[model samples]
Target: MKKAIGLFLLTINILLMSCANANQIKKGDMLFKITFAQGFSNDTLSLCLNSCRIVYNRILSSDNTSDGITDLQISVFKKNDSFSAKIFQGKEISCQADIRETIKIEIVLNGSSQSFTIDTKQGAYLSIEKNGNDLSLRQTKEQVLYD
Candidate 1:
């Protein structure tokens, strides 16, 4: 009986961990940063955050593939109260920097990186690993919805 109980407990633990790990992006989670606007404008921040959150949720909800050969690489980790993800596809670079903070996310569909910075403390900007650099709040709407 104890053996059966132990097996059940182990199964439950595995399930819990898998669920937690799968949800790398959570909507309305004030903890993960992805700025939509610059400066201290709360309205811009809120709009950007929510819109991108939805995009991320959709992205992480499944294993995204491209060209049937290249697939997205989404690595997620957390330190203290913050969580971050390095999302990208195509070829991997050797000089990729470790990203961990509230920052604006650049969803680059076209493989060119556009650089921009937002100065703020409310949250860190979110971004795609190397594909996005010149993304705007409206760009999230442009992200393709996978069925």
Candidate 2:
């Protein structure tokens, strides 16, 4: 029947459109991962792309005085060669970043403040570690697995 054939064609078109959307990655899109290696307690972490705050996490004494978030992942996509874009976590939020600008990270703990900057055009992985009174930040390479 013509109705059955038409329905089949419509389904096929929908499938193709979904596949194309899923595989599309625009230019200037970047993925970043931040890891708190050790000594993160009762701290507030803020991540900014250029000047837009994309992620913020705070852990106080009442919540869990012992541990904080260990890993965080963020995906940034540039909008049409402009300085504005959307950041994707579980949802999309408006953010701004320039490829020539650096990502800023600020942390406050124990009445002390620390600031760090990551080059947006560089690697994707970053590690933060605190030893005694010193805090260190470094860009790390992702581990590769072979099967």
Candidate 3:
């Protein structure tokens, strides 16, 4: 009977430790979904997050022009109110950002450069669309749907 009780207590302790560790590894608070519209033929997309010192550039291409829309999702985690940026291809990139500061977004698409600032206090979902020779940046609230 005593051995059984000790075993039960040890199992409970292990479970509690795992639960605490799970809380420490948290998902990002903000998720940025960047969509590149079709018709991009070896165009360049440059992004500068938070600072202008380090610029992340990506070559935009359409594998199949008929249905070749490229989407990149960036997850922003806030820790101690500091921010940094990194680039990853074909995968979601996670970074830390300060909610109180404005994030600077610089894009050089199709030989034209444009800059935009975003406040991520409430999170953001940004879209980049190219129309003819112009590029537009738009931010929208993300909708959560449960099935």
lDDT of each: 0.35, 0.58, 0.58
Range of the 10 consecutive residues with the lowest summed lDDT in candidate 2? 60-69
Top model by TM-score, which number?
Answer: 3
lDDT of 3 at 54: 32
As for model 3, its CA RMSD to the true structure in angstroms is 5.6
Clashing residue pairs in all predictions, respectively, total 11, 0, 0
Model 1: per-residue Cα lDDT at residue 41: 13
Q: What's the TM-score of each model vs. the native?
A: 0.24, 0.57, 0.59
**Candidate 2 lDDT score at position 138:** 71
> Per-residue alpha-carbon lDDT of model 2 for 40-132, expressed as tens digits?
656565555566666566442222323443444445555554334333345455644454546666665555767888775577666666667
Error of 2 at 40 (Å): 2.1
TM-score of 2: 0.57
In order, what is each prediction's RMSD in angstroms? 12.6, 5.5, 5.6
Per-residue CA lDDT of model 1 for 1-147, tens digit only, reads 999999999999999999998855444343333322221111111111212331222222111333221233333334344444444432211212333343443342333333444433433333232212334432232222332
